[model samples]
Every structure is written in structure tokens, then in C-alpha cells.
Target: MKKENNLDKITRKEAISKMGKYAALTAIGTFVVLNPLKAAQSSTPPDDTGGNPFD
Candidate 1:
């Protein structure tokens, strides 16, 4: 059997750091993509009457 080398193994800290970076990037990307839609939806004035606007 071949012995495993320490240099080839990933440490817990390194794994956690990589995961954190991916999470942060995903969050930023999601926000960027959704922010425009959110703004557009909010720009429309709300109807005071209790009726569906789409009707």
C-alpha cells in the first residue's frame, strides 16, 4: 500500500476557508441577479382597492 503524503491532503482550515469563499460568492451573485427584479417590482404603486391587479 502507498503512504499518503501530508502535502497532498487538505486541512480543515483550508476546506472551511474555501467553502466560505464559495458561499460568499454565491450570495453576491444571487443578490446581483435578484436586485433588479426586486427594484422593478417595488417601483409599481400598490392598489388601495382589494382587487387583483392582474385581472
Candidate 2:
């Protein structure tokens, strides 16, 4: 079996901080990819969807 790295272990607080950073990064990535369309939409009034998305 291979040995684990003792040098790279993180504390619980560090892990939690890293989780928050990752979540924020993911949110920022999604927003960046979606921002162009959102900006355009915000510049215009929304059209009626016939009261239903399936309509």
C-alpha cells in the first residue's frame, strides 16, 4: 500500500475556509459565463411568456 502525505494535511478550520472559497469560485464562474445574457436581458423589458413556460 502507498503511504499518505502527513505534510499536506489541513485542519478543520482550513478545510471549512477552503470549502467557502471553492463555493465562491464556483458561483463566480457560473455568473461570469451567464453575465452577458443577463446584462442584455436587464437592458430590455421582458416579453410575455403567454403566462406559462410551456405555452
Candidate 3:
């Protein structure tokens, strides 16, 4: 059996803080990359083909 060490353990608060930081960074990165594309795409109207409902 292996021995457990206190140094290897992480508290709940620390884990939550780390996760929050990662989530925030991911959100910011996604927004930075996609925001411009979204704005550009939004300017164009979507195709509204009133085609046959049952094709």
C-alpha cells in the first residue's frame, strides 16, 4: 500500500478557486475569438425560404 501525504491534498476552496479561474479564462478566450465573427455574421439576414412544409 502507498502512503498518503498532507502535501498532496487540496482543500475544497482551493479546488473551487482554481476551477473558477480556469472557467473565467476559457470564457474570456472564447468571447475574444468569437465576438468579432458573431458581430460580422449578425449583420446579414438569415435565409427565410418558405418552402414546402412536408417535402
Using TM-score, give the best candidate's number.
1
- Name the 10 consecutive residues with the lowest summed lDDT in model 2: 46-55
Using all chains and alpha carbons, the TM-scores for the candidates as numbered come to 0.66, 0.53, 0.65
TM-score of 2: 0.53
lDDT of 2 by residue, 1-55 (tens): 9999988999999999999999999999999999998898889677876676775
Clashing pairs in 3: none
Candidate 1 lDDT over 1-55, as tens digits, reads: 9988889889899999999999999999999999999999889786699888799
lDDT of 3 at 34: 99
- lDDT per residue for candidate 3 within 1-55, as digits (tens), equals 9888999789999999999999999999999999999999889776878897689
Clash counts for all predictions: 0, 0, 0
Clashes of 2: 0
- How much lDDT does each candidate structure score? 0.94, 0.92, 0.94
Error of 3 at 35 (Å): 0.3
